[model samples]
Target: MVEQLSRREGDCFLLTPNRSMSWKGNIRIWLAAFILSMLISTGMLLVGAWPVLPFAGLELTALAAGFYYTSRKCQKREVLTFSQELIRLEKGLTHKEKEWELPRQYTRVWQDVPRHPWTPPKLHLQFRGEEISLAPFLNIDDTEELVAILEKKGLRVEKRRRPEKLWF
Candidate 1:
């Protein structure tokens, strides 16, 4: 089913549920991420000797920021839509929302699906004239479907020469 929804507080559109994606996969990965973040944060707290507290505090804060950003990014249940001139995506937590903009002329969309049951598909979009990837959380199918739709709408999509490493 093709459903279109307006982004809550933006002049953007969201297209979703061409088919329901596997939330089990998304959940497992998020669980792993939470555990990994906790483990690293705890390890830093325990082993970082002399400057321990302060350093650990910083590390924990960074982790919190990362988690907050990630959760905020994932809160929405929609994939964004755009035309050839502009692209916008909505993400963030319950009350605080964030949006990102990419001029279509300066962005490239890349799609990759790894071989892991819990690994959701990812779409890596690079902006800054290909120097930085602005957003990279979109799952594989979402990426492909969105790309196809956008391509049909005449947006430029490019294939990456190499896979972009997603380190979150």
Candidate 2:
């Protein structure tokens, strides 16, 4: 999701991934799967297959962990505030884990075109020879929208084509 926040300080852009399922919906789905798996595992236990119970528990645990990680990832975001001469970036999941303030004139926006058509292009902010990826979870359209916003703000965008060679 790309949202523009109205701010007196500067133009603010909030970048977050779009998640189709709400937490409540996710919980309900996981609960249903849990109940079904437990019922089958318990039925196996009664049939003298005790090992199925532990394995079921392990499988459910793994499923719960994956769900939790995905939920947390959805909470991640990047807030970019472009002032007249400076750019502020606040990135985190729920809280500001990383914040950067750099001179807008010196910062350059970079877009890397991937060789494969299935893969989405990458966007990054280059400052002082170091590059920071910008909203990696954004899809192709949203990525292009971000680039448009950056260009509108007068940030120079450099496009790069990724190499096609596969090397270990």
Candidate 3:
């Protein structure tokens, strides 16, 4: 998820990951799904199909595991702030966070594309031989959009080479 927090005259760019669903909503949905599954499992048990009860329990476990993993991933986020004087990148969740700051004049934006077509490109900020990756989860289109935003913010954007096409 990508969102433009604010776009003002002085404020160059503010990029933040979009949170589509709230944690409360996720909990509600998970509870509803769990209850429905339990109801189905009870019906199967009443019908003399004892084997279905164990399978249903396994299904519930899998569903709970899936929800747990998804919620954890959703908690991670990246925030990029670019202004005239400073360029900042903040990543990770609340408990564990990493931040980097560089002068806007010396920072250069570029995309590192993989040789394989299947792999997604990564947006990077390079300054004085140090490189920091910006948006690793974004797709090709979102990466391009971010580059455009950076360019608009007066940062030097290195043009990426077009990938070679393979014909079967």
Candidate 4:
């Protein structure tokens, strides 16, 4: 998702991965699945097919772990603030945080495309010989859209390089 905050001095762009399911919704779904699995496993156990019980428990455990990790990742965010004199990039999750502030004139946004056609391109900011990747979770289309928006807002945008083909 992309959001713009307008200020008297400049603009702030907030970007986050789109999450179809909230943590609460995920928990509800998990609970429903757990109950259904337990019911089926208990029925099988009563019918003398008891081995299904342990497998059902293991399946639920794995599902819970997967949901936990996904929800954690969904909480991460990237914030870009562009003012007259400075541009700031802030990205992090709950446990760790990173921030960079650079002179607006010295920063340039570019797309970094891998040599392979199958790999997706990435958005990056280059400043004073240091390059920082932005919005790693965004898909290629979304990254392109973001680059367009940044360009429209007066930020310098470098074009993606053409991928090279190899003939053997």
Candidate 5:
């Protein structure tokens, strides 16, 4: 999602991945699954199916790990600050892990055409000779919104319009 930040100097925008479920939500889901797995494992153990017990434990462990990693990824975000002289991009989860400072005039926002209709065009910042990816987690609508917002900030290179289809 794209959010505007109040800054006395210049424009600031916060970019975050769309999260269907939060950390707490993920934890709740994991807990429920763990309970179900334990109940089934315990039942199988009573029937002399001891192998299922270990497999269930391993499955629950893998599920927990997958949920944890995904929740962490969802926490990641990027902050873009466009001041008069410099354009600063900060990326991190909870804290600033990486940052890039480029000249405002040298930074340009561009995108490549999407291969699929449902997918949004991938946005990138052209700085000198390098291409820096921006908001790769955004969906179709949010990606277009970000492009529009960047265009208002005079950072957009070209516009890509969505095709209209009347047939459902």
Candidate 6:
């Protein structure tokens, strides 16, 4: 479950990426590999084929590693705080915080970019001749929601349309 919760003071938005057990995503891939590995392992055991045991074990290990990495990388939490002059974002695993002071009358834009279902949405920040990224672990809808919240705080969003038929 992914959610954007506001702080008690309403000065910030806390984005938390909750643990998801829904096998709708990469779990399917891992399960398939695990099943295949189990089948091979069983076949090897039944036929007295000891060499195949290592191969099956290695395949199962690979699948477990993949699942662990994917789950960890997908989890995230970000806190977007707004002040009268600047917007601060605390993001990443370390929750390393960064701040961007708004200009006196700046243009805010939301660019419509193409995104894959498995990939997280990217936040592009431009201020004081510097470009930084915030909320690098959010999905597209969450990105758009954050953008809208920022717009209410008086920032411009520039968006580019995503082309149709993304797959080549």
lDDT winner? 2
Per-residue lDDT tens digits of candidate 5, residues 74-147? 98899989898988899999999989998878787778677579878888887888878888998889988988
Backbone clashes in model 1: 5
2 against 4, candidate with superior lDDT = 2
Q: Order of candidates by lDDT, top first?
A: 2, 5, 4, 3, 6, 1
Q: Compared with the true structure, what per-residue lDDT tens digits does model 6 show for residues 1-168?
A: 234566653477777655565435667877787788788788888999878888888877887787777677665666766666556666665556454554425524445465655655565666656666666656667777877776777777776655676556
Among the numbered candidates, top TM-score falls to 2
Provide TM-scores for the models: 0.43, 0.91, 0.74, 0.85, 0.89, 0.66
Q: Candidate 2 clashing pairs?
A: none
Where does model 1 exceed 4 Å of error? 6-12, 15-74, 77-84, 113-120, 129-141, 161-168
Off by over 4 Å in 2: 163-167
Indicate the worst ten consecutive residues by lDDT in candidate 4.
112-121
After best superposition, candidate 6 residue 103: deviation in angstroms?
5.8
Taking all chains together, the TM-score of candidate 6 against the true structure is 0.66
How many residue pairs clash per model? Answer: 5, 0, 0, 0, 0, 15
How many angstroms is residue 146 displaced in model 2 relative to the true structure, after the best TM-score fit? 0.6
Candidate 3 has an lDDT of 0.75
Candidate 6 differs from the real structure by a C-alpha RMSD in angstroms, to one decimal, of 5.3
Please write out the lDDT profile of model 3 over residues 20-126, one tens digit for every residue.
67778878887898888889888888898879878878887888787777777767677777666888787886543888888988888887766777776787889
lDDT of 4 by residue, 40-135 (tens): 999999999999999999999999999999999998888888888898888987633999998888788887766766665788888889989888
Clashes of 4: 0
What are the per-residue Cα lDDT tens digits for candidate 2 across 24-62? Answer: 888998999999999999999999999999999899899
Model 4 clash pairs are: none
Model 6, stretches more than 4 Å misplaced? 1-10, 16-19, 22-43, 94-112, 115-122, 160-168
Would you list the C-alpha lDDT of every candidate in the order shown?
A: 0.55, 0.90, 0.75, 0.85, 0.86, 0.65
Model 5 local distance difference test score: 0.86
Model 5 regions lying over 4 Å from their true place: 159-168
